[model samples]
Target chain A: MAYSGFRLIREALTGHKGWKPAWRDPEPQAHYDVVVVGGGGHGLATAHYLAKNFGKTRIAVLEKGWIGGGNVGRNTTIIRSNYLLPGNEPFYELSLQLWEGLEQDLNYNAMVSQRGIMNLFHTDAQRDAFRRRGNSMILHGSDAELLDREGVKREAPFLNFDNARFPIKGALMHRRGGTVRHDAVAWGYARSADRYGVDIIQNCEVTGFKIENGKIRGVETSRGTIGAEKVGVAVAGSSGKVMSYAGLRLPIESHVLQAFVSEGLKPMIPGVITFGAGHFYVSQSDKGGLVFGGDIDGYNTYAQRGNLPVVEDVCEGGMAIMPMIGRTRLLRMWGGIMDMSMDGSPIIDRTPIEGLYFNGGWCYGGFKATPASGLTFAHLLATGGPHATAEALRFDRFEKGLMIDEKGAGAQPNLH
Target chain B: MIIPHPLLGPRDAQEFVYLGDASLLDRPDWQHPEAGSAYYEYLYLRDNPAGVHRELWFHEQGDRSWLVVTRDTTTHEILSAELASQVALSKEPVR
Candidate 1:
């Protein structure tokens, strides 16, 4: 009789009487329709779309740290849709389209600069490879141009066209690829989602899964247990540990990818350029800082301490391209954990576990696919159906021998 | 032949010059008077001869300076390798 009376009081005071949860108790209860794990760009975008598209209000995005505190905030902020694989090509193209309209869509300035991206070729074989890649992009309606020596020189006249170490021969340029402000993307999504009444729970860690009868009931978090019919894990770097609670092991290698920025200088580098032979890519930030990055730490590590050798190699490549950058000083360096998959692709599909879904394995390219990833992930979660463009990216493809290897000869991530 | 193009880096640019005979380097290595540097390599171009005869080149990316190289145009063999100091890779600090 007392328990029944307490239940009656709880039901009556839920929203009307301002019943509060234990975490925010003494204030008022905060209930949500859906619970999203990981408050990075993907999670935040997911909540935002859920509210906008489906009118699914009362969504809560729980983050162990501040919003965008994971790989989303630490990435290089490259935005491109130069994928060559079958299923991934169209899907990423959609992302590129979304990026084109991002400023107006979010009503925030993401600095979506489409300066362009060039992949320099050093050998005949490398040139042929770019040719094929360009053809692939062209097939998908993407603007990929094959530039010869004169063409390359016209684009980057400062390059050492005569020097022979890593000679500037020709290049493959994706005219649509560029960059964005990584932090602004996160905050914009957070604010937009917050405006939709989605709870942004920072410093709330999900400790375990609440499973009952082979179905997800809620999540056990550091704050407390929250009941929900479905759960989505959008964590990138720490995705493995979170999914492990459901006895699942994904094909992901956690490594720290570091990026560095040089002191502010005049605009020199006209576009983001990459050396095909070496592990180096560079672009001048709008702040006049030359931003660049190279290969990962090449080992499994969650720590963000980056080694110096890679940094040196990347800078060396940069100097080879533009000798004038010698006066620039390195401002700061940072490292972010990347969940690199075997093929350097992402997995955005529902898991075998009922009521649980996952959208991760972005490798080092998550920043570019933020909007499309969230849209597709939510679509798959709501309908239990994968998009035709991402059908080949099922988690079980690893076991089914249906790998969508895009690099043709070298599909392995290490080779990439 | 292959020679380096300075001003780039340790691995930047190389100039491939095709010549008639492989007896070019036998005379004497011509060191650039400006930069006080001397180094070069000579090689031959084997197949697909679009030019008249052999080839001579320079490898400027080696050891920080360019190499004024001469090579056999037909066989693509190195004939003479001379260092050219006209091109300096870079003296500035990389960020």
Candidate 2:
């Protein structure tokens, strides 16, 4: 049912008996026109756009676990498009645009809080880099502002502004960037896709791809062998393992990136604040908990848990910037496997195998790029060509020496 | 995780830079006919085993020496560690 204020009052007056499930737990069919793997935000949103925008039916999204069980629910929920690269800026800017109208579009409360995001700069060189990045954002029709130490103090006074080692010199502010309720994005997309007759089959693990004559036909799953004319794999961290089942090794590495939340407190953080000298970035959740994270555990692994040293390191980075966080008790912490591509960017293109497609290598940027990744992926799957905004995100970019090395970290996945 | 360094007594894993799979040391000849595919496989494809794995770790903050570390990925247990230069010299010469 389409949710509305009138509907809420009617339901309240009628004892809420007319409520229904948001999405159906439909059984997997024997065949489908298209199959989208992984039911995280990207997968669900892909299916939603495929049905809504592309007018494709008989689509199914197969998930090994329940929706929002992956990085979708395990991220810091920050979103931004303040990128310096041409290949990245437009795509992420489109995601921010989609996020702006997401709630109204899906008729779901996603809590897209565009409170703003500030990247604190500590040194003169760092300030110049951010100035260039802010200029790039403005060039791409996105909002950005270069703020000095005084401006940063006005925005977030709790930071350790006078830290001897890494004093806050300035910041690059993107007013359109903020956080969203991560899981609600999955729920909203899943519900909308289901409304369009797209089957969402959970607990269906794809064991292998049923390819014959070097072309795709369907997939072999734990449930059964389901046939599909086209298959799209959007499994984030499992990209390497899943694609290997089809005898295709991706240019990706799986690493665990951990995130943390502290005990709830009164609202203190004005917006998301990223440490200049370190990897720490934090924002206050609507629930009053401080949601934060740092770098990925520097190893290749599919595990969803991190060790103590990284935890200590992340806390150190947090304390380096905002010393007040040193007193806060960490409520909970978890890790999500990152599909770290060599160039620190993502790939949204068709794979070498005919009728098979891949959408992964998101690293730390996956959650923020959900809407546009889905929209562009849907465009690719439907049209058999890369979307205009995602033309550079091809698997062959590395071989062609056209790597979109956003971080300029070279070809090292760990460094990215 | 604590990695027992060969030269240094013991060091936290945080102090070292992890580069997965010691097989990266086996660089194929760039003059080979299949060098393109060889470099592709060398740079991208990884074994990513769940059990015992021999990986490379650079002592970035300490001796600055690279170590060949064999550890259990499933349990994070360090089996052994050695100087990567020594391990490279001891390996079968590259073609």
Candidate 3:
């Protein structure tokens, strides 16, 4: 049912007996026109846009576990488009624009909070770099502002501004960037897609792909063998393992990126604040808990858990910027396997195998790019060409020496 | 995790830079006819084993020496650590 304020009141007056499930759990069909592997935000959003925008009817999204059980549910929930590269700025800007109207479009309360995001700069060189980045953002029709030390103090006064080693010089602020309710995004897309005649089958694990003579056919799953004319794989961290079943090796590595939340307290952080010298970023949730994370564990693994040293290192980075964080007790912590590409960017392209497509290598930017990723993947699947905004994200970019090295960290997955 | 360095005693894993799969050190000869494909396999293809693994770690903070570390990935247990230079020298055949 479409939710509304009047519906809430009516249900309350009627003793709440008219409510129904948000989305139905449907059984998978023996054959479909398109099958999307993995039911995270990207896959569900792909299905939603495919049915709503592309007018494709026979579609199914198969998930090994329940919805919102992957990286979509385990993230810091921050969103932004303040990128410096031409290949990246336009795509992420489109994602931010999609996020702006997401709640109204889905008729679900995804809590797209555009409070703001500030990247703190500590040195003169860093400030210049941020200045260039902010200029790039403005050039791409995205908002950005360079704030001085006093301006940063006005925005967030709790920061250790006068640290002897790494002083807080200024910040780059993007007013349109903020956090969202991560899991709600997956649920909203799933519900909308289901309403448009898309089947969402949960607990159906894809064991292998049924290929014939180097062309796509269907998939072998735990439930049974299902036939599909086209299949799209959007399994975030399992990209490497899943694509191997199709005899395709991915240029991706799976690493565990941990996130943490602290005990609830009074509202302190007004917006997201990222440390300039280290890999620490934090934002306060509506529940008053401080949600934060740092760099991925520097190794290749599919495990969704991390060790204690990285935890200590993340806390150190937090304490380096905001010393008061030492007092708050860590409530809980978890990990998500990141599909880290070589050049610290993502790939949304067709694989060598016909009828098989891949959408992964998100690293730390997956959660923010959900809507645009889905839309672009849908465009690619429908038209058999890359979307205008995602033309540069190709599988052959590395071989062609057109790598979108956003971080300039070279071809190292862990460094990204 | 604490990696017991052969020369520097116990060192935290944070100070070291991680490069996957110590097998990367064995570079294939460029003059070979299949060098192009071999280099591609060396750079992109990796055996991501879920159990025991031998990897490369650079001790950037303490000694600035690259170490070959053998460890169990599932348990995060360090089996052994050695200087990469020594390991490379040991791999060379005597004329």
The prediction achieving the highest lDDT against the true structure is 2
Model 3 chain A worst lDDT run, 10 consecutive residues:
A407-416
The list of candidate 1 runs beyond 4 A from truth reads A1-31, A408-416, B1-95
Evaluated on CA atoms against the true complex, candidate 3 attains a DockQ of 0.40
Tens digit per residue, CA lDDT, model 3, A1-416:
99899999999999999999888988888999999999999999999999988999999999999999988999999989988899999999999999999999899999999999999998999999999999999999999999999999999999999988889999999999999999999999999999999999999999999999888899999989999989999997888778878877766777888999999989999999998477799999999999999988878777789988889889999998899988899999998888878777889999888888889989889999999999999998887889999999888776666878888652364433
Tens digits of per-residue lDDT for model 1, A1-416: 11235666776778535433212211112444578899899998888788777678667888888876788778778888777777788888888898898777776678999999999988898888889888888899788999999999899888877657777779999999999999888877777777677788888899998888788888888888888777888988777668877767666656668999889888878889887567778898899988888877554445665657668877887777778777778999998877766556788887777888888888788899898887777677667787677677777665554656665321123332
lDDT string for model 3 (B1-95, tens) is 89999998999988898988898888888888888777776676666555677899999888999999998766778999999999999897411
Query: Over the stretch A1-416, how does candidate 2's per-residue lDDT look in tens digits?
Result: 99999999999999999999999988899999999999999999999999999999999999999999988998999999989999999999999999999999899999999999999998899999999999999999899999999999899988898889989998999999999999899999999999999999999999999998888999999899999999999998888888988888777777888999999999999899998467799999999999999988878776788888888888999988888877899999999888888888999999888999999999889999999999999999999999999999998887777888888752254433
C-alpha lDDT of all candidate models, in order: 0.70, 0.90, 0.89
The candidate that wins on TM-score is 2
TM-scores of the candidates in the order shown? 0.74, 0.95, 0.94
Q: Model 1: which docking level applies?
A: incorrect
